[model samples]
Target chain A: MQIEAISKANSPEIACVVLCCRIFIKTASAEELEQFVQAHEMDWDEVYKYAAFHRVRPILYKVLDNCKIPAPVLGRFRNYCRALSVFAFERQVESARIQQVLGQQGIVVRMYKGLDFTKLVYGGDIGMREFTDMDMMIDSRQLPELAKVMTAEGYECSQIEYLRRFPEHYVANKKDICFYKRSPMGKLFGFEFHHRPGNFLMDQSIGFRELLGQDYLHHSAPFSQEQYYRLMLLNHGASDYFPNLRSLVDMALLSQKGIGSVPEQLRRVERLSQELSMRLLDGPAAATPADNVVMRCATRITKLQLTVTLRSVWERRYMHIRFSASFSDTFRMAMKFLHYLMLPNELDINGVQLFSFKLYYLAKMVRCVNFPGRFKKVFSRV
Target chain B: MTQHDIVHRNEKQFMISNLGNEIVLMDIQQGHYINVNPVGSVIWNKLAVPIMVKDLIHSLVEEYGVSTAQCEDDTLKFLQKLQQHHMLNVQ
Candidate 1:
């Protein structure tokens, strides 16, 4: 019932959108479902668009059967659920295959966000969580083995030059080298092989690799349940300034179920997420009257075409990335930013051949030259 | 379509998943899905490559204990259903 007052049609706030999602993750009573639909049926399309943007419609679809979902909404929801189920299946198969191969070969690795994480967060249902990419954490020493095994499994190195071309960015990010395998339908999912944790901005040490290493790993070091929640919270709070509500819901769902006792650090992180943004219960309390318009404008990469403006950019940046800053963190980020600009290399172009050093260098040069213009635009907004 | 007409899968239209005892085929183009038994699963896999209907019948008769006439009838009906759903194209 309370969820009905959340996201309205045409313009939906981020807090309301997340609150609407909580109805499904936590499972609503029939009365609550009826009230929600009765209240928001007219403007449900806006909620649908919001859910689609966040890539969380499939999880919500499971609850449709218990409620008297409208025909049009049900059709759209079912179609999305089916499509997601197929992609999730593909991701699951590919991820499992990779893990199987690597494990057989005795390459100790940790699978981060993929089918396993979906199962951990949303139970063992195949399509409960949308999986666009599979993230794994392996030691830097295992890079050659990762490449070979991925190649054997028909995965092509998406960015082979980034490691050598921009050592500073590589060191700063301490992240994955994505490898891709295209499905029969031409859909591509990347196998992001992470080496370490922490970013230039966040000094948090809750990485799955570091958390469940050696004996606790069962020789594979798959992300333990609690560890995944911890990482999600850490990432949402610190490393990833623009934390998606879907991810927060994932943490909440796990926390609600009381799976894997929450550590003191994670409990602190959860409370921080509540304080930083609108929490699970806070509805539209923190949301502004124009937040929906601002959100619609901020979602530039999606179907919406909001005109870019200085204030809109500032608002979008403010909404998406709200980071806690210390002098040292800013100093380190500034250094990393400058170093990346000096020698840019993290470039992955669609249909472009990775082996072409000339083309790669050309793209890198273009980014480096235009970096100043982008940097100026950021400050211009504020 | 003639019985001798070549029959293979219009892979662009269909996505087949073998679920042990059941064969699930999704007509992605039409947004419809159908399931068949183990017998249909074998026939579907055999239809991966272009083959004459008679040849498919012969293979089915040899592998399955069903009579030639029954195999032909059932297979024809199954193929026709596939065609009706746009899961297959009969030339």
Candidate 2:
């Protein structure tokens, strides 16, 4: 893609980060990278900020290590890379231990995106990807037994605590629960147990059994190449709103592994994500569709800010509704948004007594009464 | 184990990564990390297969152009530390 095209709405610094990450994936050449870096007269601070925010710092460090950069700035990047490598190593060790324990209990849990992708896509060099937590797919029915095992292993599930107080809410809404434990070294480790492969917005929840097959209990490979790519598209693209450059890089790398064509059953948001990724990596000519409508939608989504902000949140929700697969899905997303605005979960009233729960509800209702005005502001910004 | 004995990595107890110049080893059972420097990383890589301590010292002396006495002393100290941490299988 043209450098100007890459920076259309994004700051030049963000474009640099994206190009650097692309270079690491071999979509762009080192000479082009050198020219881009030197031509921008870049702000090193903004480059670092966006790179870290997008969780592409490791890739950025790899590409820029050979480039002409200030000594101190390069040192900072190296330090982050080293720290992430150690952190990833620790998580791997923890993942192996948990998998072994769960295996002995006759409950198989297959790892997904985080460390699994590090090994699959990055050649087992965890430093190439920075992931904060581990994601594991498990049988939803086994949760009660899994909870027991997790507790025995010193993991605390706050979702279970929430479920105890409001079982109906949890059962109706949540497909995953996070278990956390602090290491002796004071580092916090998180493991998210997913019962469903994709989000609630998808047409149906593809269960672990359906996606990985019943025979997967004995098989080592968690997902086939095509299934893994589809999962990435749905979970990261459709579910997450394709929020980061790292996701794009992941799609790019996975596509090169001979995953064949994108599935025809993809949701609107997922299609848009795929088109945008292809366009960014291979330029506009590489876009498969001659359809102006799809190209327009992809371009619009690309122009949205990649960072988290109130405006971006509103934009993402708009995209979610606009790209929803069905009217019912749109309605569900709308209802969930209102629910989030009006309801106070356990964490919101953690220290409050039982009687104060009603007071808390009343206060929330009063605050939500003014939500229309806030909604108007968000809409106007869009 | 004496200096003449063979030593190898206790591979089952640790997960290792050679990051850039340093070798990082995570002790799976203890959740402790040991960062090995470039020289120590060379020794760790050499220990992938078993090697006697005396031979290890001799190889380092040849490669690094260090005196025999100094190489032997440093190599023995490093090996003893690994043994203390149960990261080495000495025979």
Candidate 3:
């Protein structure tokens, strides 16, 4: 997919943000960036909020520090960047420690997305990228051992109780288990252990282990560059519905390294995400007239899917089915989602193990019936 | 310590990054970090190699155009804080 230039129709704040990110990714020249910044009457508050919302504050700070921003706004950006730098550094240290310990226990794990990509794309500058959790891929068989090691390291597993009570059900339904630990500074760090890559609805015919190959266990570079980019696009973009601009920046940077063609199943979503990024961040000349009409319709659908106020379980399930690879995949995903909704998990029952578990399902059905009235009350206030 | 003492960054004890004009120092043992302002960044960069307090003050006074007396006072206080955090090594 090709990334076009930022659209001129964007608000001043959005334009500045897009331009700043473009400069960071080296797609736009610094002189062009300076000219755009100087010509516009920018709303610094909006720029800050938009950057934060998109999880691109670090990139914004990095690119705009050289531009002629107001001193107070620059200071705010710098302060945030510095704080994130500290957090990223701490996450790196903690991750390395965890990896070392896990390695000693004969479990092989691979880091993804966060500091790993920071090293790969940002030249090891942690502050320029932000990630919510430390994502690592491990062999499914090693999960029990991994959990023990995590608990020993003062981490609390989110699914420990569930897994302990109904291991079979938990494994069948969940792709990853998250463990969290709080730092002395009171910041929480989440470490997600993925037994399989991609979302629950993603087709798992080719497992991550197979894609990474036999030497994955001990190879210094477990995934080839192509495989890494593909997994990122699928897991980060399509799976999570392209939650923020950071994912697009990641794709843009990876593409610069010359990624092969995206998988056939992922092409549409990848194109749409790339188009959205280009439409918002870059100019619009790359798309032909025919392509723009299709993109316009797709972009609206994506925006509606991403709209927080309108988001619901039904909307998410629709997205899952919409993005499914095949007719069979769609049916499978719909069935899985129905299973997820009808069945009450440990959280729903407050971890109480019942003899039948059917009683909880009945309660769930009653709650579903009352949901519309409850939603009406909440929606009225909004 | 007097102006004759030599000081340098405790590189072995902290993971440091130069973030634009500011500096971030993460204490490896403590898992906490300190943000050094632009002036502190200048001082930290200069301390890359061992230098005497008098020379450090001379460089700061020249670069920032501050009074020698004021630079010495502020630099000493900053260096003392680093020492308190164990982020500096004095000789």
Candidate 3, residues A320-378: lDDT per residue as tens digits? Answer: 77656567977888897777688766554443445555666765565566655864453
The list of candidate 1 runs beyond 4 A from truth reads: A1-19, A104-106, A164-173, A204-206, A213-223, A259-268, A276-278, A281-322, A325-328, A340-343, A348-366, A370-382, B1-91
Real contacts recovered, all predictions:
0.00, 0.30, 0.41
Off by over 4 Å in 3: A1-10, A104-107, A215-217, A222-225, A261-264, A283-298, A301-317, A324-333, A349-351, A356-382, B1-14, B30-91
DockQ of all predictions against the true structure, Cα-based = 0.04, 0.32, 0.39
User: What lDDT does model 1 reach?
Assistant: 0.57
Per-candidate TM vs. native? Answer: 0.61, 0.76, 0.76
Give lDDT tens digits, candidate 2, residues A1-382: 5666666655678778878876777878878878877777778988898888778888887788778888787778788877887788878878889999998998878888897877777776767887898998877767766888998999987666555555455545567878999975589999998877654444454555554567654677556666677778877766676677787788778777866555455545445666877666652234344345456656664655333232355565566666655578779877766665566555534423344434656545544564667544533443
Window of ten residues with lowest summed lDDT in model 2 chain A:
A304-313
Clashes within 3 Å, all models in order:
0, 0, 4
In model 2, which regions exceed 4 Å deviation?
A: A4-10, A100-107, A165-169, A215-218, A261-263, A267-270, A283-287, A290-297, A305-315, A325-382, B1-12, B36-91
Best by DockQ: 3
Better of 1 and 3 by TM-score: 3
| lDDT scores in order | 0.57, 0.72, 0.73
